[model samples]
Target: MPNPCFSPALAIPAMMAALLCISTGARAELGGTMSSEANSIAAAPQTLLNGALRLRTVTDAGNTTINEYATNTGQIIAYTWQGPTMPDLRALLGRYAGSYLTGAAALAPDGNLHASRVARPDVIVESGGPMRGYAGRAWLPAALPPGVTASDFH
Candidate 1:
C-alpha cells in the first residue's frame, strides 16, 4: 500500500527549498523592503507605532524596540534596535553580522564586548549590557536614506 499523505512534490528536495525560504525569510535586514522584513519581526512579540517620514517602530520581545527607517519608495533603508537584551543580531544585521563579528574580534579585548561599538565600512553596531540591562543598535551606512541622521535611531 502506498502512503496517500506522501507526494513526490513534497519530496526531500522540495522540503529543503521550503525550509530554505523560511530560514532566509527570518533574516531580513537593512536594504530589504518592508514587506520582506515583516517576517523577521513577526517572530517576536511586538507593538507597531507609526510616525512621520513613513517611519515605523516595532517594539519586540522584552524591551527591544526596532526603528525601521524607510525611503520614499517604502523600502527599509536602515534599522535601529535597543532593549534590555540584545535582539538577535543574526536576524537584525543579516549579512552584516559577519562583518560585525570580524570587527569585534579585532577589538582591544577590554572585557566589554557588550559595551563596545563595532564599526565596519558597511555596518555599524553598538551594544552594552549590565546583567539584565542591555541596549544596542545596528545600521547600514550605505543604505541610510538621505538626510536621515543616526540620532534619529533613538
Candidate 2:
C-alpha cells in the first residue's frame, strides 16, 4: 500500500496552505506608521537629507542589506536594497503591492528577467542585478518630503 502522506492531492493543498500562511504573515509598512517590526529588524537609525528623512539599515539572514527611508512623522516612504537576494515586495509595499504586481505584469517582456521597472503615478520600483548582486529601490512619489527627489533614495 502507498503512503497517504505522499499523495499528490495532499501535497498540493499543503503547499498552497503554506504559501498562504507565509504571505499573510508578512506585514506591509509602506504609507503606514512606523512599527516595531521595522525597528526589531534594523540597527540604529540614521538621519539623512539634512534631517528631512530617517534611514534604517538592516542586513537580513540572506546577507541582503535593506535601507528603509521614512519621514520625520514616522511614515516609511521608500526602500533601497542590495544583496544576493531580493527583499519581499509583498511586505515592503503594503497597500501598493497590488499596483506593483499589475504594473509589472503589464510590462513588455524585454527578455531580461534580471531587471524590471514599475512606474505608476503612485509608486515607482526599479530593481535589477545579476545572480549574486541584486539592487533595487521602491518609493512613493507623493510621500517624498519637500526638496527631496527620487535620486536621493540611492
Candidate with top TM-score is 2
RMSD over all Cα atoms, model 1: 15.6
Q: Candidate 1: where are CA atoms >4 Å away?
A: 1-27, 36-53, 111-114
Q: Which ten residues in a row have the lowest lDDT in candidate 1?
A: 1-10
- Write model 1 residue lDDT over 1-154, tens digit each, in one string: 1112211221223222322343332434766665523453443222223332345667666567766666655655556666665556666666675676666666555433235566689887665555456565667777666566556665
TM-scores of the candidates in the order shown: 0.64, 0.78
lDDT of 2 by residue, 1-154 (tens): 1111211121222222332344432333678765534456665568887888988877766688888888887788998888987666667777887777666656666455466667888987777666777787889999999988888887
Clashing pairs in 1: 114-127, 114-128
Candidate closest to the true structure, highest lDDT: 2
Worst 10 residues of 2 by lDDT: 1-10
Global CA lDDT of candidate 1, please?
0.54
Model 1 vs. true fold: TM = 0.64
Give candidate 2 regions above 4 Å deviation: 1-28, 35-40
